[model samples]
Target chain A: MSRVDVGALVDEARAGRPLAVARLISLVEDESPHLRAVAEALSPHVGRARVLGLTGPPGVGKSTSTSMLVSAFRARDLRVGVLAVDPSSPFSGGALLGDRIRLHDHTTDPAVFIRSMATRGQLGGLATATPQALRVLDAAGFDVVLVETVGVGQSEVDIVSLADTTVVLLAPGMGDGIQAAKAGILEVADVFVVNKADRDGADTTVRDLRHMISLGRRELGPSWRQPIVRTVATSGSGAEDLVTALADHHAWLVSTGALGRRRAARARAEIEAVALRELRARWGGVRASERLDRLAERVAAGALDPYAAADELVG
Target chain B: MSRVDVGALVDEARAGRPLAVARLISLVEDESPHLRAVAEALSPHVGRARVLGLTGPPGVGKSTSTSMLVSAFRARDLRVGVLAVDPSSPFSGGALLGDRIRLHDHTTDPAVFIRSMATRGQLGGLATATPQALRVLDAAGFDVVLVETVGVGQSEVDIVSLADTTVVLLAPGMGDGIQAAKAGILEVADVFVVNKADRDGADTTVRDLRHMISLGRRELGPSWRQPIVRTVATSGSGAEDLVTALADHHAWLVSTGALGRRRAARARAEIEAVALRELRARWGGVRASERLDRLAERVAAGALDPYAAADELVG
Candidate 1:
């Protein structure tokens, strides 16, 4: 950590060098010991980027929609960076490079950068790595950083917390609309995209989403209403409308002061995650492991409960 | 915390009184201040019950399967308890009382107990409450405690980690086979139950699951071979086979020393969770929040990154 030259990385990053940005992100991903020194150097240059999150079930055209959105953003002369968080395919190991292939369309453009990241082991680590990567992109002068996650579980909730506007995508004929409601997507979606809108039952999917949102609004009253947009992402139709909806949400977030609040909450959570990791690192020792083993054995033997065991260990 | 009379509660629980068991579980659900004392009081009487988790998507007949399992277990004169964790209907609050109605058939029998718990306020709290409630039932002399949760997202993963044997249920034509593979149920399930086996496309669902599972195993080798059991929980048609599969898995776990390892892992996780909760409680103060706001302000203003802010705060 101490041996790395942080000033050079920051200067090159601010000079619009993607290599510096990529290097910084890799340090974060690798949990490099010098992460703090790099952060300290880049901190002054971060936060210019507007974050947009797109998440949905697999095969919902997430990559297609993301590629389309990148084009739309580029048309406005905005520099963009994309972080695709996906699990490494068990067979080929990061072999599901679908997003990367779609993103290859922009490889020659200096204004765009796209990187594919694995979940890296567990849910908790993803939360820690993603923000730092976004910071690297922001510091490197990207006007927007789009985070796209395969929205299946709780980690999708984490992704939503990072975005100023989070779009939860769905498609027709999959019964995903109902699954969305069941998974509490009704709470997280800032903008809903019924991708592949040309497909049969697209209208039904949109109607079902609108119905659920309205019902949810009545219970959780007086909020910015989530707008459902129809899009045929592969054809790039309706991309403008989706972008406009996202822009409107961003504007709403800024004006309502929720943007600051969400940022502060995110900061709070990030601090807690770091603190927990730090504590675990410090708490790792033979003494702790031996005590944990004894307590686990006792708990296993029905001689103590976990809470009591934790109390004794922490004490 | 010390004000509660935990000794009396434990005395009643040891005497096989249902009221005491119900009260202890309520203490857990409410996170009553006396939780540790209750855990301490009941610790020596625990570890005798077999904990089984039945989870699947909505409408996959988890409740029916659980009910069938309870009857199957009770036929041998073993007492049974049920803990049903469902999302709170924003309108009526934990109103998914479907399990309650389904379990009415056993209410007249003294050997059966059923309770429904909501996710309550936070995800972490449910993780805390569930194990304690299970402990209460275990100490109350129930030979089997079945935990049934809707396998939709992160909370379901938490539920899976607590069980000695996890049964992930699915049905034929709802596309749950695809959903199951998508949700990573292929990894957590000890036994797969394709309920409503009388329905059309049951064979296809079974075949698809088997195929996906084989592919996964080829990539990630060695462990318990998850047995797929088709069952019509409505008529109890494959209930015995499902029971036998479960018993065989349990026996395998015991013979291979997996039971101790799984229990130890569960205890280790529980201890960490409790320790984190304690850390948060101790870290709670105006001082922490003020520091958070100051660091958040710097981060928001682009003068500091989140990792740096976290480091400054935690350090």
Candidate 2:
């Protein structure tokens, strides 16, 4: 389709047309020829949604926890949209159980929209189309949009950068306790939840987690006191408390005037990431990488050093 | 140091100077002012190393398995380098235990080099600086490089694109068996390993794994037989078979001319990802995102559509 049609789709979507919103997101996610036009059309309905990212190691019961959280918010009469990232099977080359079935409770609920996405080999922790899909949810008038990551470590951390609020979940006795101290999850966690607290070693994991917080204090002032909560998700125990904690965190963000800053940071990251993708694509079309590849080859062969090659590429 | 002196570090590293290599890697990982020069200088020794990736869910004993594999390779007199990428903690702002502490047995070995990197908040499955660090490792004359990704579900598959061979590990009775299959790990695995074979239900897991493989037989071709080797890494059981399987896979790559294709594909992906990052950084610096943000505000208020906003930004 021509760029003009994309523009029209965004405009229509903004006028409360679901199809328009879907089409706009597809364009933006794929960066098709009409993406710019589509984005322009949908831009008007975007900013009010509060984006939250729920991420952690897999089997931390993220889906169950997310479903409970959605229920909590919906009880408050909030329109909620859940985006679950279904990981692609590396062996199958396609999506299987690609739907986030844990949220089936909301399947018939008109106010809650849950969509699952396969990574589709996007390589980075996210599907190539994730940002666009999020935009679609945003434009659809959802008051809160929750993005569930596939719990891939490095990329999972990236998800925090995308959200105004990021929740990191951990389980007891995972032996990841020490690794968690290394600071990847801690760095991005606005809130930490000890899921499956019914399991043994929950107390030890919590104690260790608290200790790790003290370690970050070495560099920064008194370290941000990240709130950690415990929950047995299977029985929905402490789910309400978790919701309250979320609300409290949100309140604190507003009270501290950190909400705006966090949102701004996310926007900047998103814009920068998108721009980087655009530039790289353009560079390839221009064949600028050939020289870089040649330099890479030389460095690989041990005939020259990498720094000199990088300098030459920039030159 | 001036550019010329920086070139000496690269030279020294190529000449078996560990300090120079370490420093170069530090510069690359930190994206320091000297990164370009360091990369350029080390370009010649970069591609000689054969890089492999080990990926799977956490608790699959990847670290232990990797250690055993290191021992095996060392026995064969291969110089090895390991890069472990951890997620950045949201709370503390540092990388966690993603470093290979379990592999401490080889720390004193001159033939083995191990380093850990944080995602440094880079989005996607990889550390932002990993590719560059890898280039440095390659340039440093490492015969084999092993990359262990922080298992984050589907995004972990990105490792396959960069490594010559990807070994995906699985544990038995994960209970989330179907979920694992759904993440797409099955597709990218050059070798499927059922780690912790000593655990109960290991056979069932293997049979299930095999059954899953049979479903996609048509797409992968009849020759694509992914051997599901069982292993108990703690005791180093079945590691030998695992190594042999890797060799067999490597041989198949060469026999079928897939190795060349794989390299070509990796090169293309590397350039694209790198280009994207660079472009995004440049655009971010120019404050182009501010305008987008302003447009987003208008869109959020229902005053304009995203498509029109995008067109304005691009135009």
Candidate 3:
């Protein structure tokens, strides 16, 4: 491939050229050699977009909800970007295809840009790639960037926690309350979204969440109380209420100066992940390193301890 | 604190002194400064124990099943070590208390060792710690070491995948078949246990597992077919059957030479994790680095891209 002009691409992306934006995000995803150049070019135009994260279990209608949110944001004359990240399986292109079908309404809208990303099961792949993709969308002048990840895996949760406002979606009859509590979702969630509210047991789900929030509030002591918004995303029911709740959370974050703290924390994590990835690559990674293989053989044979093996490999 | 004589501790641990074994595991868990000495001292005596991993979602009776296995192993004149690892919450000692209660039958048995470990929510805590603890148990002359991790999180699954024979447990009415598939349990399990077999839906659960197994067998192509054992663990009804299944799996692993492959892979992961941890320590870790904080500030303010900031930090 010929060397691309990253500066020109950045200019075009900033002018809302979708192809340029897509190319920049692809560079991020592929970990291209020009990734540093792309990042450098996109740096100045970043940090203006309000990054929102949506996460839930598999059957929670996350894609439909994301589409609804895009429509809501676009209705307000704001350009929106959606990144559907699947951390569960590297080979599951099924998630992306399902997302495309659900998000068909925004396919032809120039103001809406949607992309799906899979980690390909790389260690810290989502951590390193998602933030860079967000930067690309931000530089492209999107007013809001929504990062939607499936499942409750630690990596997925960590990615969503990077957003300025994190929305945890739950559906009735999924036993999601227990699952959510088990996954420590309450700690990371800034907004609780009870999606698929048209189903039975929705009221109970909402009440259970409210009760859990009350219990948590005692320990948190006068912070932002996560609001439980009920939404039937298929019909766009309660879309306005969900949007208002997000706006309220954002306003609270700005007023309390938590936005800066959250963003700095997110940036800290991204930089560390990138540094670690680069370090691993320098050492030929854990899988392909012959030195690692020899040490592992000795360790497996009980001739050397893992720690000593690690010391030798690092040396 | 006085300096520990790791050599003496190893000698006593190998002599089957419970206190010495406990101290070595504690050293590993605390990431003590003498960790290298402990590892070196225990290295020669490691790699003998048959490591068995038991994992499932909560309410599948994992602790009860582990206790039953301990009884079965001890009945055959083998020393058993149990490590109850809870990856869900650092502060939740509830799992340990519950495990102790369920395992009360072996509380006074000298041949049975039980330890409960929490990661304290540390990054890669389980990845680096569990194997070292396994070494401690192995060096202490345990014939069988059972690593029981609660939940089906990625880290929990990764830890279990290190074992020679991994058993995934499920109870009737838990919707665990779907949960297991979602967590990629199908790929890791060497044996499947349908615990709480006396409950309703046990037959359906077993049939569902059999169907899933058949579907998976096409890709696996005549490898070890995971045997499904039904047991009411509370009554120890099928404890002998479960034990026989484990023995069969171990035999298969030895015959196919997969045991050596699995152990080497486990060692590879351990050595790589230790090397990365040491490297992170050298850089004062991602959490405590002043350089990282400065770079994060710049990146958050849009003055620098994360990739460029990472390059500076790594340099």
Q: Report iRMS values in order.
A: 4.0, 4.9, 3.3
Native contacts recovered, in order, as a fraction for each?
A: 0.54, 0.36, 0.64
Better of 2 and 3 by lDDT: 3
Sorted into a CAPRI-style docking class, model 3 comes out as acceptable
Runs of candidate 1 with Cα error greater than 4 angstroms are: A1-23, A55-68, A84-123, A149-155, A169-183, A194-223, A232-237, B1-23, B55-68, B74-77, B84-123, B148-155, B169-185, B194-224, B232-235, B305-308
Please compute DockQ, using alpha carbons, for every candidate against the native two-chain complex. 0.36, 0.34, 0.42
lDDT of 1 by residue, A197-308 (tens): 9999998998888888878887767779899999999889999999899999999998999888877776666666666666665556778878788888888787778888
Tell how far residue A187 is off in model 2, in angstroms: 2.4
lDDT of 2 by residue, B41-79 (tens): 665455678788877765667777777888889989988
**Weakest ten-residue segment in model 1 chain A by summed lDDT:** A86-95
Arrange candidates by lDDT, highest first: which order?
A: 3, 1, 2
Off by over 4 Å in 2: A1-34, A86-102, A123-128, A214-225, A283-315, B1-17, B86-102, B123-128, B153-155, B176-178, B222-224, B284-315
Compared with the true structure, what per-residue lDDT tens digits does model 3 show for residues B1-315? 678999999999888888999999999988898998898888888899999998876567777888888888988999999887743321124444555576666867888888877543445666788888999998899999999875444566667767999998888886544454544777778899999999999999899889988988988879788899999988999998899899999999999999999999999888877887887777675555888888899999989988888888877
Q: State the lDDT of candidate 3 residue by residue for A1-315, as single tens digits.
A: 778999999999889899999999999888898989998888888889999998776557777888889889988999999887743321234344555576666878888988877544456666688888899999899999998876454666678767999998888987644454545667778888898899999999989889988888987778788899999998899999999999999999999999999999999888888887887787675555888888899999989989888888778
Q: Candidate 2: deviation at residue B254, Å? A: 2.6
Judged by whole-model lDDT over C-alpha atoms, candidate 2 comes out at 0.67
Q: Assess the local accuracy of residue A116 in candidate 3 as a C-alpha lDDT between 0 and 100.
A: 70
Best by DockQ: 3
Native contact share for candidate 2: 0.36
lDDT tens digits by residue: candidate 2, A82-112 = 7776343211122223323544567567777
